[model samples]
Target: MDKDDQPERTVTKPQARVVDPPPDSEATLIRPPPAPKPPASPAPRKDSGNQLPVGTFLGEFEITELIGEGGFGIVYLARDHSLQRRVALKEYMPSALAARTGPLEVSVKAERYAETFDAGLKSFVNEARLLASFDHPSLVKVYRFWEANGTAYMVMPYYEGVTLKQKLKEMGAPPNEAWLLDLLGPLTEALLVIHADQCYHRDIAPDNVMLLKGTGRPLLLDFGAARRVIGDMTQALTVILKPGYAPVEQYAEVPGMKQGPWTDVYALAAVVYYAIVGKTPPPSVGRLMNDNYEPLSQLAQGRYSPKFTAAIDRALIVKPEERTQSIEELRHDLGLDTMAPAPRPAPAPAPARPAPAATAAAAAPSAPAKKGAMVAVAGLVALVLAGGVGYALLGRDAPAPAPGAAAPAPPAPEPASAAVATAPPPAPVAEPAPPPPPPAAIEARFDPLQDFERVAAGQSADFGVEAATAKPQFRIDRDYLSFTVKSTREGHLYVFLHGSDGVLVQVFPNAASRNNKLRAGQTITLPPPQSSWAMKASGPAGTDHFIAIVSAYPRDFGAIGLKVQDGFGMASAEAVAEAARAQGGAAPLFLGKPVCSGDCVDRYGAALFSSQQIP
Candidate 1:
């Protein structure tokens, strides 16, 4: 790539300047001119080794025109046909080491670049996955993404907005405290949400920040989690960073150089400083060496609140520890004290009931209470018996038996009280219903490699072969394992963990885990209610495997008919492939094959299937 054709970048590492005290008078305020916007993208590049052709289909998205290009990738304005709407599509085309072989495959230029290329590919996919979890108004939404041809692509909503830097350029001056506070307030809260998820938006700058044209809401765009090896990147040291906005920690590659919320704080503070003064803040590296950059407190006296200005200055501190550590502290300094914190997890479940305690409590009341009631009832019963004997003898008019003499027989003459009543017997007591049973642990689903190998025998070389079968690395034993399987393109993920002892467990779409459908470029993880496979039970010491089969459409696992017993399901993957092939369920890719003109990716169901051992 020619230097003139490449995207315009700012990567100056100017010599350190002498330190000076901040200005106390307005006359000393030396506000710099606004930084220039990034140069317009050149005409769409041709589809060759490392680029996609215009009109090529990436699952649901159709590439329309190249919109932007950077050192690592290209962005395109595309149409999402399924929804019939426009979207911004980003493609990972790291031309430094790899290129596209077809509209669906990538080839590395050299063997040495393989690991670095794979690392960047994984990072791009991971960036999409992480951003998918966020839904803030001040954050761009990543709808979905997928891999095809040789690189990965991310689908995001195409919004109308100018970057903060561009907005400042048009304004010709710093925005007032009213506009800044309203914008940065919600923006700070959004960063809090991102931080809570344990993520750092390492690239937060005026250029990366956008003010939405529709609502005037500020969105922090293009988070830099896809920071990868710089040696492999074409732009030397500054490839992953915006020089003036990036913190000191980002410049060094030291092992203990930790980055966290504090790194984001520095970048965001620099953005605030830029909005106040027209120019970019001095780079953190330059500041650390010479310590000569002016502070915000000195720059804003009567123009902004003292507390707000001070917080910004503190956050701009060169050392991470001296800066405001959290968004809450920053907000507090700005006097938004009553704002609520982010939503937290629900309270934990109640502790289990102790049987002995219940039994003891029941026993404590039972004996004493029963004794008192019994005493009262027994006395009344004795009184009734004594009175009955006396009444019968006195009213009978018959003689009682004398001492030592034979007793006279009692008369059976009491046939008088026909109206005498008896109480109905107590209604039979009902027993309480038993509690419902606990949820059944998911049954295992397994597709053996032998079966898959047998099935792939009929498939073309692109479908892979025996040498690629069940490449189990024996790393995990006598411990639980978490698994994730990500497809290069959008498709349904049917995952099965085949234990060493023949137990086949379905990780997705099980009774316990039901997310069988995957979005384009979806990365489904393990232990599914939301994620992928997890093996809890340890079995015999042998090779266990992960069998993943993704198709362009969802398949009915019921139709394939696998033997299911003890909550586990097992079928040969070969049977599945044979079934699919016999049914013409998968598309055939040819080296010199005649290609369809229409959207073939969606029209014909193509599958890229593979299996590997669980780590």
Candidate 2:
């Protein structure tokens, strides 16, 4: 397609307004008339009656019907002549308003227009570059990209199955547990690869995940909103978040809150919740910021396991800090935590010392024995020296040889006597033992989600009741918890958590809500704190469900303190007893009263309470 031959775009004008000049005399300053309207650039010539459609052919692609349109451009189904395959081609739309607006509007629009174009082009190029770097079965493949007539388009493997959203609508809200389990692993794996590449798919929803016609795996699509993990800065374009599925941060205008793995985690959990439950999970940080929602386990009627609900909970925490911090953490919440940790390099061994070589001189034979006459003379001299030293040292000890002089050598031993003495005492012999091998260190591995399941099952066994159906499961860890539950009866599931006090802590609604249904196979992570609510069918009218109750004792010490005042004629103990009775002593108390003395009594009513003591 030639640039000049493309059709001219239509531009809509803003509503016109009449403004009155200020009454001040200076307002009278005249302004020059606007320049005569330039002849309308003849609308770019349209195709002749017999010409092919606008998106027909470019290079070897045979463009088919338009499949979708968006703010920046349109997408078309096309055939790749070279490969004989179908593909999706996204083309950018040129701005026509830029030429008609006033100077300021023109400038702003021009900048935005340029930005949109650049961002789209950059995203197309980056997505291709990133996706081309890996070949995960769950990720859509980008084959090629190019520009024609000043519009850029990327060719991606066309998917035939309905989007998760469409499937959800068809199935109704809250699809079955079997559906959730099947899709969780593949989606998680896809996310792991994406994050590993340092890219974030800002837009993650059921609509972007397509269930391929004949494959079990779901293909993640639309990298147009994906952004590189560089700094805190968000992509130049407005962050595009699907309202119910997007985390609160995505809705913030400030760039600092825009991009992070938590955003994707939230979206992922939403999809899961929608699959298991039939409705979107309640907002954890938005309107339901206050802790006042039912637990996911109770809500789902124990249809899914608690561990599953906990996984989704952690993924959707309102505070990113409270949510799953990394992809590995999210994976762990799902049953897929068994993945081997990255291999660590072994440590280098220490160098060994070389042994010294034996010397030739030391190993040589001893010299021959000296003459017998010399030995006899030396013995006589030694005898004379010993006798003289003994006589001189009679008063104390024998005198020693002169300090600097050498001592005389002894005579050679007799052969027979010497041999007998030498052989008489043999030194004791000792045996040596072999060295022991090095001790080994044991490595630790654990999956809390799995552990919870075992524990929950064991507890249920004690009661002689097997889990009839897997309810949403949840597992709480130090920083986060995750769980899953049904959001709607039509299979629009959501996994969300409430604080122990019943406050909604987080929610992850399924991305697909069009028909409020979900496909049979879908999975999602529940938000954290091991707290969540799962929606369940009441079974037409009446069905018994499990409910966890925690009761605390009320403390009356403060009331007793207040009764100790001098004004109370009765004893402090009696007054406290009466007050306790007045306050419904046996009932569960959520608050308590403080000590009331002279001043306190005057300021507050006698029966006024201080802090509500938890019972």
Candidate 3:
């Protein structure tokens, strides 16, 4: 704990303003002060002060070790050297409320927690600029974030895999309920992009998630509103709450204690009840004073289903107004579907509000809300309401805060059954929905940013379906969709499609399918995983967006700015992401360079989209 000694770092050399002599004859050429630019880095010393030991570097990454330590941050594995690989990084350091006098400095341990440590460093740089504009693959890609020596870090991508709490401790029990809903259906579409940016991972447990290795996918890691902004900057840090996956309004801040996405929908239905009955489910303050927690449709009744044990017992209702507060109604009672086809209609049950007649023999079903699928992100926004969980102070399994306790009473009114039902968004289909039920199974998953914000809102957003599957629309010029790209590491992708003058063309390995490489986990598939034109297309219909773009090296999308639109056509998607950020963030055809971290050009692509109408 010997931290303090770090002071010398002053290099303020920007004084070049003294120019008088341009009246059409006077001479005054003086430009010699530019040579003092060598100190752009290397100043934040004291590595051992707050710890960055193993080969410490921080600029081109290097640290190579210590990958754990929590009450806020400190990860590390490092390496990077301008991308030769290996990263992880992290480091916000709230260890009992800050220290490190250097190696990128941090201080606050007292000064009365400095306005809650600058509101938990402005909520950890606004959840790292909204999880670096999330582009899901199950999450965790964020390749950059910095500050130098005062705090903040991030970096990411070192993933190798394994933590569904060590794959449920090397499979000693519980997993295959259709492989835990295909790894929680891409973590329920990456928690619908962190509740579509209103935010709230509020710690999900199963040790924050992971899984990756050979593309077993399932990402979501560390984020309980980033330890409640380090439990609001030091009450000696504590509040990492988990007791059977926190929910009695995350154990209290009082005056109507709240948290939404039914508080990470009761810790993601108690991490799917500890991944199918290995343990943990009783403690929402002991199921609000006496529930004994049984009821995965009455104890795993027939291995699971009754709408997946009634969406994990109405998201383990110990009452947050009787539970299941959106993740699109717990991914429609675990059946899943929200951003795609819309006539969006499933949520309307949980308000019996005052609980207890034993809830008249244990009730359920209040999950509604979905009509006309809108999805816009940031501004020009339309839907994503689950954003009201403000005022926080919640904690449990302590380091402090157990000194008064109080909360455990809220659960007295009861009745029977009427809420917990879901399956509604299919009736609004203008096309693709009926042909997917019989022996024709092929769903792959979709939501390329909710079809690029539903074709930047002029509407028509669905995009070729089949990848972990979901469809109820998309069929204008005679539907024909297919996809498969299977890479866990083998680099080089670039696919693009987006037709009907919506523009984006590139399509397949190009030169009519040739060199896009990709091997690792194999699979490939689009019209050339073995060719034959299976991805069908035609006239000026409506939505398309296939896209892809994976990397590890192989860029050049028309030398980075990809103007297209002449015949390659892409007139929208924010005018090809503002012509890939008007190419000055140093070459960006929609974001690149090891998954962009800062001045983020755009991050290339991932897309899925599939809707079409004018038939």
- Report the lDDT of model 3 for residue 373: 31
Which residue runs does candidate 2 get wrong by more than 4 Å? 1-55, 94-112, 226-239, 253-258, 283-295, 339-615
Residue-level lDDT of model 1, residues 1-615, one tens digit each, is 001122111110001011111221101111121111111122324644355566665543457677787757878887543233466888887777776665456678899978787788778877786776685666666655555555676667676667878877887667766566666666787888889988878888888887765445677788754544533353455667777677787877556456778888888888888888876678888887898878788878888788888888888887676777777777777765563433222221211111110000000000000001111222211111100000000011112221110111111111111110011112212224343221110011111322332222222212211111112222333333444444544544455443222223343333223344555544455443322222332222233333455545444343233333212233332222223223322221010011134554421122222221222
TM-score of each candidate structure, all chains considered together: 0.50, 0.42, 0.25
Model 1 misplacement above 4 A = 1-50, 230-235, 253-257, 337-615
Every candidate's lDDT: 0.47, 0.36, 0.47
Candidate 3 ranges beyond 4 A from true positions: 1-105, 108-130, 136-144, 153-187, 191-202, 205-238, 246-266, 270-280, 284-291, 296-305, 308-333, 337-340, 346-615
- Candidate 2 lDDT tens digits, 544-599: 11111100111112221121111010111122222333343322111122123344
- Backbone collisions counted per model: 22, 99, 49
RMSD of each: 31.7, 41.6, 27.2
A best-first ranking of the candidates according to their TM-score comes to 1, 2, 3
* Candidate 3 lDDT, 382-499, residue by residue in tens: 2211111000101111111111111111111122111111111212213344753311111111112223322221111111111110222334335544545543345566555433
Tell me the lDDT of candidate 2.
Answer: 0.36
